[model samples]
Target: AQSVTQLDSQVPVFEEAPVELRCNYSSSVSVYLFWYVQYPNQGLQLLLKYLSGSTLVESINGFEAEFNKSQTSFHLRKPSVHISDTAEYFCAVSDQSNYGGSQGNLIFGKGTKLSVKP
Candidate 1:
């Protein structure tokens, strides 16, 4: 089984300031990591993912995350944030070894609320 943990429940930052959302995971088997963001009154959208090969992944936006296997962490970061970036961020992990059952099922952490203020 795989599980994710978000270190902070809420992160408040000023617009244009750098921010990081910490995420950690534990798994008995190989896993894939993902960051999902949900804007106000919107559904969850895939932000970035680390399946294999490269350890770092970036979203279409300015956000980027590095998959550190040794640390068991995939922390999301941005050099500068905007008011539009305010949202609930979730860290999820999928068991890559499990292909037959619950194919798309992912274990998720309690979301972190990112609040960007002016």
Candidate 2:
């Protein structure tokens, strides 16, 4: 199965701290990468994606991730995080066919809980 794995179950940091959420994947064929953030009791927002061109992608909010084809990984990073960034971060993957197409139900990792202290 084409699946994503988030190694860190949770990452706690103070406001304005830097953070990283690790992720890995295993797929038989090509795949699209994504990082989605979910606020407390809220739906997820698309943080970023690695589709075709660039290996590195960023979100408007300062989060970024690099798609490492060799390592089969896509890890999220933020130079300085805020308390608002406290949320659950999910790493996902879709088959190449579903990249631009309908994002069919995403295959999600268990998720990494990011807690930013005030």
Candidate 3:
């Protein structure tokens, strides 16, 4: 079985400040990692994913995550954040057993709320 843990429940940062949301996972087999973000009054949206190749994956919105196999961590980071970056971030994982690229069986973390202040 695979499980995900997000280290922080909330992260408060000033605008233009850097931020990092930590996530760790435990699994006996190969797995895929993903970051999902939910803005106010919106559904969760995929921020980035790590399927294969490239230990580091990035999202268009200036967020990046690195897959560290040794540490079993997929931490999301942004050099500078804006007020719009405030949202709920979720870390999810899917083992190889989940067939056909389906995202139905993903294990999710408790979620981290990013609060960007002026």
| lDDT, candidates in the order shown | 0.94, 0.90, 0.95
- Candidate 1: list runs displaced more than 4 Å: 100-102
Rank ordering of all candidates by lDDT, starting from the highest: 3, 1, 2
Minimal lDDT window, size 10, model 3: 95-104
lDDT for model 2, please.
0.90
Instruction: Tell me each candidate's TM-score.
Output: 0.96, 0.93, 0.96
| lDDT tens per residue, model 3, 1-118 | 9999999999999999999999999999889999999998999999999999999999999999999999999999999999999999999999876675736599999999999999
Query: What's the number of clashes in each of the models?
Result: 0, 0, 0
lDDT of 2 by residue, 7-103 (tens): 9998999999899999999989788889988988899888899888989999999999999999999999999999889899999988876645537
Residue pairs whose backbone atoms clash in candidate 3: none
Clashes of 3: 0
Output the lDDT of residue 104, model 2: 61
The list of candidate 2 runs beyond 4 A from truth reads 98-102
Ranking by TM-score: 3, 1, 2
